[model samples]
Target chain A: MKLLLTGSAGFIGSHLAEHFLAHGHEVIGVDNYLSGQPRHTRHLLAHPGFSFVEADVSMGLPTDTGPLNWVLHFASPASPPHYQQHAIETLMVGAQGTQHALDLARRSGARFLLASTSEVYGDPQVHPQPEAYWGHVNPNGVRSCYDEAKRYAEAITCAYHREHGLDTRIIRIFNTYGPHMRPDDGRVVTNFINQALAGEALTVQGDGQQTRSFQYVSDLVAGIAALMALPGPHPHPVNLGTTDAITVLRFAQIVRDAIDPTLPIRFVPLAADDPRQRQPDITLARTLLGWSPQVSLTDGLTRTIAYFRALRAEQQPVPTSGPAWMRGAADAGQSAATPGD
Target chain B: MKLLLTGSAGFIGSHLAEHFLAHGHEVIGVDNYLSGQPRHTRHLLAHPGFSFVEADVSMGLPTDTGPLNWVLHFASPASPPHYQQHAIETLMVGAQGTQHALDLARRSGARFLLASTSEVYGDPQVHPQPEAYWGHVNPNGVRSCYDEAKRYAEAITCAYHREHGLDTRIIRIFNTYGPHMRPDDGRVVTNFINQALAGEALTVQGDGQQTRSFQYVSDLVAGIAALMALPGPHPHPVNLGTTDAITVLRFAQIVRDAIDPTLPIRFVPLAADDPRQRQPDITLARTLLGWSPQVSLTDGLTRTIAYFRALRAEQQPVPTSGPAWMRGAADAGQSAATPGD
Candidate 1:
């Protein structure tokens, strides 16, 4: 199968590209490197089945990439820091980029999968978000860019599916962390692992009570591939993530144990519109796609920590500003501000 | 104050333009008229304060528009029939048009008010929907074009407010009905009124018990203006709607009575993602804007019925093709059978 993967140089996209290529699929990956790294796809350059295109989907699709079997649109900034920094680009990817990719997929008669996010379920009141839970989101909040763009992206993809009958799948991805995870990625798992490896205080937000379920990248990629491969009677979004919930403080402790025994943990104010609790109810994924996160957080963090450590040993500049852990010192402390009213 | 109003030729936008003009504001109104009617604004063509430019905001801003004091972005296909006809255009207006308007608002240091919809709360689970409901939407469903685009528009508007302090105000406008509505606008008010005027069957979706509160255009405009003029503190989305909830059957009856007493009513299957219930909890509006609906549904419908009667009496041709109510019953019936997956 020939697959065209957008955002193929990002953490999850790179992993997905690698998975498809290893499984004897011809992978054509594209990225503008706005937030993604060329280094992420460096190992794949020599692979016979993998080809990379440095292009922006928001500008338009690659000129005449004819007749592909599948297009996995993983473009757009998935992390808060990257999205917040380049909001216009983030929105364009959601609106224009998704449309362009869907157009390509439609023309080629290729199946398309959009990488949506749990952020669409903004600060959800439901304990474990089912596919049905309408989220409780502040549309005017600081985090609206990432959350709403993904929502719109999902909508446009659906429009293509319904109006044009393009084979489309959407995965409402939860937080996933693993080895190739960017050092400065603001997600919790990467933040904790990096901090623990550097022998720094692991910072958890808002008294460390906010809970999240972290799915390993490998598990998420497997789910993505499976959902795409599902032949029929499957069109709605599948919630792909671990259902096991854990407090941020507990996750910090686990990371401290895995990386360094003596690293202290600290608590900071939570970010605006950040969900207090998050866990995906993966019943549909189990019933339909027969997939769930197999890698435990403990195991995932061990692999992630080793990767970050090796990268640091090579004198890779640890991100000084962008990572979630280093936003501000305790002295710059303010109460946890919710996103704007 | 110089106000830039997008979708200025559309139902709500035209009304908003008139209000601003009457208030002695210079109004620069732009609309590509994709779903809008030039007839809606024909009366205002000669107004000294009114300036009209025909352009698509999704492409970019009109070159002639000057510094705006306030930007009312009411572009996009508001009616389901219009949106379903121009899905890509609808998506573009919500995404790109919104971005263009926000960019102008940011540069002009103008307060931005995004005309979002109750559609953002797609098939909401919560009743008497507040401004906080995230919405139960099928990302891959048929109606996602409008539902998700508006959600994304609101999000990007908020990002501008947060990151750039663009003075943005978002109004989750509920179903609005009044004079100057398109004859076959596909909204319940317009649809029922048209059918009753034409002495045709008043088609109700499903069992016709699905309820919604309709706000008069004037009342909604007042609420929107008050929200835009709000000073200090609460700039998030506030529900701008009436609390008068009525079943679709009841609504059809009311239109029938208002238009022609002899018209019969019929129940058709509901459209896909047609929200089962809609009533606004306008507590935030009352607290923030000191506003509520002034026109009752009966009075509003009376006025609307009169206007549409005049419109139809003038020998206006009702569109009769796909999804058209008259001769295009085939597609309507097909849509009823398989609304959206």
Candidate 2:
């Protein structure tokens, strides 16, 4: 299989690229080094089957690539802080980037898989949200950048499937954390681990009662690959994440226990619009892909902690400030004009 | 107030324009005549201080009517059937059109008001959804063109406020019905009314237990004007419709009674992703706008019924098909890609 992987140097994208390359597929990895680092996929640079392109997918796909077998769109910021920082870019990549990839997939007749997120289910009312559950999203909130963009991206993808007869796959990915995650990715796992590793108190927001189910990246990639391999045009989104849910407080303790065993947890006020609970019901994934998460949270956390520790030991910058591209347009004074501006 | 009203020839837009015109405010009306009909605002054509521009805001605003005081962006295909007919156009207009309007508002230093919808709340979980209720939305569903597009529009609007300090108002309008509504509009009120008035059995989908809260167009326009006139920069949305909800079956019975005494009703399969129950909690509107829907459902229904009766009496050769622009697009086919095609 020949694959075009957008955001190939970002966390999940890099892992996905490695998985495909290791499986003997020729991989064309593309990233603007925006949120991604060269080192993430730099190891694959020497691999004959792995080639790289430095480009933004929103600008249009490379004009030269031949017809490909699969197009995995994993671009766009996933985390809250990252997306909020680059609102317009986040939106454009979701709109323009997804369209460009879908156009490529249509021309090449490849199965198109979009990496949708659980954030689409903003503070859901359902206990274990199913694939059919329409999300509870605040469109005008600070988090709208991620939630609304993913929402529109999913809609456009389905339109492409219905109107153009493209074979499309959509995965509503839940909280995923694993090795290669930035030391300060602003996600719970990375934040807790980095705090513990630095011998600092772990900051757990809002009494730590808010819950989330975190999927190990390996398990997430496994489900994605299997779903892509399946036949038929089931365009409905499938929830792809672990069902094991835990409160932020508990997760913080677990991380602290695994890393320092002595770090104290401090609580802070929760961010606006933060979900009280979120646990995906991956029944559809199990029934359709015959898959469930294989890695336990403890195992995943241990591996992730070790990866961060190694990077710290090597004195490598975790790129804590993020790539230059993650800076939101708001700060740059190039913020988009409203009807008046 | 000097107001810029997009889609000023459509149902709510035209009525709002007339209301503002009668109130002696300058109204700069713009419409591409997509779903808009000139006849709705036809009377205002001869009035001073009422200007109309035949242009698509999705591309960009035509001439910034310098130093405008208010902006009411009522563009985009609001009806479900109309939006579903031209999926891409719905998304584009909601996104790009809103963006252009937002830019224009920013440039002119005018307050921006976005006419969002109850569709933002999709098939809701809460009995009486509040202004802060994140919506239940299917990102990949068929109805997403309108639902998700409104969500995207609201998101961008909010971003403009938060990131750029734009003075913006968002009103999540519900099922508003009144005079000038397209005769065959697919909204339940119009659909049932048209069928009953035509001496045909009214169509009720599923068991008809699904509920909706209807806001009379006058009340909605009032709420919109109130919000737009609200001082300060509160970025949160305000639900502008009434909480007086009724089941679809009950509403159909009322429509049947109102239109024709002996009309029968038929049940059909519910449309995909249709909300089972929906009702807004307008506490915020009451507190914020000092507004609540003033017209009773029966009174509003009578007026809407009268308007449709007159429209039918005229034996107008108006197309009962779908959105005018979409119909034109399909008829023009190859030429549809060009502007003004």
User: TM-scores of all models?
Assistant: 0.87, 0.85
Q: Compared with the true structure, what per-residue lDDT tens digits does model 2 show for residues B168-204? A: 8888888888887776578898899889889999889
Candidate 1 clash pair list:
A135-B134
lDDT of 2 by residue, A1-341 (tens): 99999999898998998899889999999998768766766667878999999999978888678989999999887777888888877877887788889999998878899989888888887889998777777787788888898899899898888878899989999999987676557978889999999999999999898888888999999998999899888788999988898999999999999988888899888988888999999889999989999998878887888777766755533254865643443233222220100
* Deviation of model 1 at B299, angstroms: 2.8
Best by lDDT: 2
Q: Single out the weakest 10-residue window by summed lDDT for candidate 2 chain A.
A: A332-341
Q: Pick the candidate with the highest DockQ.
A: 2
- Model 1: per-residue lDDT, tens digit, B1-341? 89999999988898898898889999998899888886656667789999888899999886556677888899999888889888878888999889999988877878888999888887888888888766666555667788878888988887777668788888888988888777778878878887887789999999999998988899988987787777764557888888989999998988887767888899898897788898888998988778988887778777777676665544444356534454343322221221110
| Residue-wise C-alpha lDDT for candidate 1, range A180-267, written one tens digit per residue | 7778888788788778878899999898888888888899989998888889735578899998889889989998888788988888
**C-alpha lDDT (0 to 100) for residue A177 of candidate 1:** 83
